[model samples]
Target: MITDRLSLGLQLLRIIVAFMVGGYAINECTQGFSSEKWPTVKGKVTSSTIKEVFTRSGTSHHEADIHYQYVVDGKTFKADRIIFGGANFRSPKELIEKFKADKPVEVHYKPGEPSVACLETGVNFTVLIPLVAFGGILAFMAFADMSKSMQPNSSIGPRPASNSSGLAQPKMQQVKGIILFTGLVAAIFGFKYGINAIHFGAIPGNAIAIVVLVGGGFLFVTFISLLPAAAGMLARARRFDLAEKVAKLNTKIASTMSAHSYETAVAYGLQAEIAQEQMKYPQALELSKKALNVLACRPKVDLAVNKFDDSTNRMIKESTIRYEKHYNDTESLCNESYGSILFDMGMYGDALTHAEKAKRLAQDNLRNAAAPDQAGTKRALAGALALRGKIELAIGSPENAKSDLQESIRLRKEIPHQFEEYLAASMADLASAYCVQSEFRMAERTIEEGLKIVEGSNKPSHRLAKAKLRAQLADVKMGMGQLSNAESLLMESLDVREELLPAGHPEIAKTYLSMAKLRDLQGKQRDAIGYRRSAGEMLTNCFGPQYQAV
Candidate 1:
């Protein structure tokens, strides 16, 4: 069919044209492709000379342009958005070795203007690579199309007209077109509605509003898109191995970026997490790395903002290393605050170490602080020590854990005005320690007492305490062979969790396991087996297969 050949040729031409247009757009947005400025700068070549030069206050020889001195290029210039890398060089020798001497050095300047001297040449290609890649890809696609067009048509067999199906073909085409058009409309509507929803809520792009907006968007989109993607994923998830599809999806996501760097990373990371939760581990990992890279490229902020991000990233990506390493460069109080975040991430060793270090740092900083700052220092120290205690418990070092927890509780109690709800974890750990010691009565009593103190005292709403108490009570009753009592308590906990958590939460799995035991006691063999299987699946999903109960 002449129509078929023409259609194929048109499709190829469209693709080639689109790529060229996209490449041009990307190049223009990124600045002239060949002259894209390097983000990094270098000063005099030195092996050891580390110093921070803010964009605003670099020692400038010329009043008009911003000039800074570095070991690589003793007197270098700066462009816009200068930042400090983790490495701090103290000597020229160190700088030389760390950064190869022969490396091209470029200086960046602010106030993007023609001939404003914004970027220096010979710097890292972070800014240049993309501009070149997009252009090159477009050029390559154009050449490939020309080659295909020149190929002999003898090898391209035209499909013979289907005489029997000819009458049905138009209907099939209509159906396909309708379905595709509907999906396209749905996707566009979803995007517009999603954006509007966030706007109506006045979600802050940089403030706490971001969290609410992102969380709400995730919930909403998941609620809407889940059924379709899931159905599609499931049908093929089993019929066809998802390895190739997942890989392609991952590659697509990794290459895509939003307007903002950090936002892009967060999006990728969250998408990865969503994929992972849906049993798509490969896609999850791929998206997660893309998210991380996006975050890495984000602009640097103030100390408090940076610390907040460190803790937040830990929760989002489930790693404390970012918090710990970054904390060392931050204020002592912020570092101490980050310790508790590390504890929450279950990085017990790092948590303990960082907490103690933070405590010592805070105490030292406090002694050095003026009288006006003493209160803040003491508050920080209490938080640090309290977090240290919780970390101790997580590692199963009860004696030390107890000591730390008790000290933290005492300090927190002493500072009623500060309202340190995070310290409540110390109490939770203490009760857990009591449970481990087989002091059920003592454990129950302690949780009750602590619950009272935390009930309305701004200590996480006492819900956490209630959950822990329920879990412990269930276990205790089960141990005592009070199957019915245990079952009731477990069910209550499960109900509470079901109300509070998502479908596959780890706590839900734990509750299922407890219920499985009760089911076994009642001789509900099928039910027990199903419950165990579910619990196993959830545990595997949350903590992977290596996690064993203590």
Candidate 2:
């Protein structure tokens, strides 16, 4: 009885929240200022005051700012309060400096609500709908509780079917549960749609209308037809929920196991190949061992033995045990996956070993080709070859690096889509080689050509390619003593790289390091130290703390 009451209470809470969100959205939609009423206007910041300040436990703090303005919507509406609150904002000193610079500011203000002024404007509906829907749900749940209260014997009853004893079972509990579940699913969709609408501009407008109508029709019919059955299910502890969870877990384990196997194999093989290139035998052997362990296991008793609740887990265990021999034989795939992981980690030798094994398997049909040659295989081959060249270059074998890079370029040209990105990548590698060899003119041309190929790609890699090319072009210009040109190109590349790559990614770290070196060369020790710190932070994030060189 208490459980039923609590469930009803939760439903009411949900309804109330939903209704509030919807109401807010509708109000905003209907009364949100028109362009005429909220004309765009320039404002000078008369004074900015920090109204409240608070420190969170750690390295973060929050504060609210009130800005007084002299202008509003082309009419002088003075003493307006514009609230600004954000966690981890730029330091107050930095903000004050920016303000003191007297930067031109653009703002929008509603006529009656001066506090509602905004600097940047973007439309979003996600915030409104969910809150309203929750409010509505809360109200409905409360009403349900009150209605139940009117009857003294209002406990959720048992489900109905004429059993051997010939008594009709009650199913009120099941009905309530189904209703609550349906409402939760609806709430989830509402929240998803709301978030996407606000953040991604993928407002669920027409699609949402269709869904609501269709879903409402379905629920109405189901509520009428399965009313008795739903009540029955809710009345008893349903096995369906636990079964579903176990089923999902089984799927996840299978998928993750496959992925883990593949990554392990690839990382292993890559280390082997790179080791062969660099003649690092010990490292290669270690990587191979890591790959082998991906499938290694020990026997143990079942931890969860509940047949009713954990049947799916037991089934997975039995199947895996039955296929242990087969899995052992197929462990090479895991090694290949591990090798790939190593390659991505900049472990060139290990990446090559895996690539070699994958190449052989793919050609011989020993491994499952994800799709056709058009899938990842083609790119993988090209990348492996290029990485091999890079490893050779790093180990002081310039000639070998050149040869491998050329082959990679040739392989990339044969592919259909994403060819531009591949070409840009190969060219970047080639330009690096040319730069190292002091072939400035050839390096410049290669970088330029690479940038041209990236033009139509429009992918993030395209931007990355452009950044790399510009960076290399700067190097060439610097070599030629065109300091200004070098500076310009390097700065542009730095800006693009900072935007695209994560702060701690190896690529970003390398870019920062380069900038730091350049600054040091220019006798800017302080700037160099700043860049060094940035590079170090990014590197630590991209790779583990133990990662030293790469």
Candidate 3:
């Protein structure tokens, strides 16, 4: 009887809160800012009354007991719960009078459960269930993972999920991320509660609640003081949330993992790639070099494995080849990415040096490639060749560019299974080589093929490649004196590039330069100068003051 009575009290509380929310305000809250997308339907109130349920202690709970019916597919369902006040009524008495008889009302039904209806829709009580469900699943998985990692190992085997220094590794970082996430959510709720308590001016009476809240906030701060937000990094890193990417990567490096692990090296390499894309050349060079430094993991890996039993050592030794190949592949890709950064910095000598290193290392690693991992080695090799070709073109060696780009295209074509975007990229570079040598017709054909490849592939990165191909096609059209076609292609290329790239990215400047060329051809000399000046400023900002615009 007490359980049933308490349930009635809770339902009365819900009704009282909804009634207090005010007329039409609930409608705005439901439709304007509702997190859930609810479909609306027409309904009418059949009955309305105010009722009081008394407890054994003679305490009474007053609520508006209103029943409404809505139809779906010729079937009708009734609900007595009032989500909020309706019909321009400001008070419960007004609601009772307004809803005494049949009155049309708007109803919002749960998408999958049409029987479940509400007078007004907004973030309801069920929202926390999703958060708790997600957090509980992650917490359980993380706990289970830690249990496995906690298994006893030989004295020589540093903990499997951490480094020798006992700090969390990348794998364990995620495995422990739930604690931080839960603490963050707890802290937010606690802070909100404390604020409400103070607003209500319930001192001493709400003092215990405030203390519990303070403790929760402290735990949250302790976890977050470990990072700007540890949970946010785990959440947004894979989503490619650009605003938080570098900051999260920086936090990932600083907080949990050792600076020298292979995973940490990958993080550094990723930051370097981002820096290069943002046109921060000096920082990108430093970051890529740091990635290479951290990737020198051979001695540490070998030493750790040597401490095991002979049979175990031998088995681990057999797997060392895989580690070595991964190391080489990462190094080659980083070198190629660094070379491109240098090429943009106008450090042609240094750019060509690293470009050759990337190409040589990629070629050397190919001997270890078998069918299982052959695609990765070939991808690194093709990427190296493509970067070298671009660098060679910048150095005024068209022949070398042509040779390298052709090899990149040929090698990439063999891996067509998952490499359409890459093949298209290499073909676009080859088209540039042809244009540099005044072979405009060949350039047009190569670039058109590149565009066709991108259009057919449907890869997420296809639009980026298509933009480059269109830009190349524009240059070829200009060379062929098809000014109108050239202008059209430039506009298309510029639109895509501007949409996809950061404001200071090199490709955007290149598109601006093409625009300048088009304006010059059209005899709009002043507009040409304006475009040229804008392109020059952007390139200068990207590559620093040392860079000279073509």
Candidate 4:
């Protein structure tokens, strides 16, 4: 096939280029610094000239030419070598003054070869190091290819099949590309360091060395970080084996949270959402509880309240109001988060209870406060409303869900700077509610708007959100009896999810389910069955065999 031919061509090109570059570098190194035993003699300048040359690009440069005669082995020798490895440059006037007619200067010449002589003798820093480093990299690639070719077919074992409970394996091609790019960057830095080291006397050697060392250190850390991901792809181990990896990632996240106290509660709340997706209900609950506790214990000190007059008890009143407002806002957020997790776990009643409490707290804070946090209050209220909408939809109340979602979307748009991901999610939920009512056109429009909002965001999370919106749009299309459009959208959504997410992720499974439905609508029973089986396997891995969806 074409792929095999392309691979073979690339391998051959690498081998050929590596050998050619390596040979040239070796030749230059050997010729430049083979032996430093050249003899030096006094030479008299015979002639000197300098000229300015301009190219068609309108760039002008200067060059100096000088001729000298030296007595080597009792024979007069005429030479014009200014440097051993490369040409040297000087101003026209400087060259003329330095190399005055009959002026004596020192010259270094090879003992056995009088004709091969130089005014100076040493290695060339500008040429040797970069070529050698580049050549070495190419040579290594060539050697590696040869080694791979010689290895037995059995030595290269088959990759493990992806299982439901296992993390998705990254493509080997992607991994290799990352590694190669990183190696090239490291090699470039090495070549620069080599150049700098050769000119140690002319540059700040210590500073350059420190910079190179720090750069190399960062590259090493980056490579080490990618190792676990690459290894996961190779092993395709079950979820049970991922505990340590998850812990390490969580530790890093915790460290980041420690530096941003304002985000701690929300961070934990988000983690709880992820736990729910992994089918760990108890863990999700525990995480949400921790988020609530964190918010409760968090201190809120308004400097403005403290700066007010203390004699008239104004400071005390303001402090109390500020504290109450802050407390209510935080509580509302925590409650909304808890409700959302409960909703995911299919506890509609419990979720609705928390959602209502959140909504009430937010509204009360808005009504009673002298100067409420309008942004915070709106966000809390919107979240609560969205949660309630989701719970209502789950309990088969499409009208109530539609009303709440509309209100939530209205509140979100009122904010000057809204969170894109949340807005997209709320829009998707609203579209889903519309779909339940068989309002396919409205659902399609809502989801398309959500997709547009998310498409402008460059964040990885936004990409996943966009994929979900696309899938929801596909659902609307399917409901409207547009099978071709639905199939195209579903395939697009699947591609995005696969590129952005690990194998067997819940979103990927959902995309597969949608694809199965599309295939069934198209009367492709065999393809539909295959897609359904794939979705079921993924769901079983993520949510366990007893998962209702499975």
Better of 1 and 2 by lDDT: 2
Cα lDDT computed for each candidate against the true fold: 0.46, 0.51, 0.63, 0.65
Assess every candidate by TM-score. Answer: 0.37, 0.40, 0.54, 0.50
Candidate 1: stretches off by over 4 Å: 1-347, 366-375, 418-424, 454-461, 473-486, 513-533, 546-550
Residue 235 deviation, candidate 3, in Å?
A: 14
Predicted structure with the largest TM-score when compared to the true one: 3
lDDT for each residue of candidate 3 in 17-57, tens digit (9 for 90 to 100): 22322112223233223313567788999988877769777
Clashes of each: 37, 79, 0, 2
lDDT value, candidate 3, whole model: 0.63
lDDT of 2 by residue, 377-414 (tens): 44455565666676667667777778878877776666
Runs in model 2 lying further than 4 Å from the true structure:
1-349, 355-378, 544-546
Q: Write the per-residue lDDT of candidate 4 for residues 443-496, one digit (tens) a residue.
A: 988987777665544455566677788889988988988888888888888887
TM-score ranking of the models: 3, 4, 2, 1
Give lDDT: candidate 3, residue 374.
Answer: 66
**Model 3 lDDT-worst window of ten:** 1-10
In terms of TM-score, how similar is model 3 to the real structure?
0.54
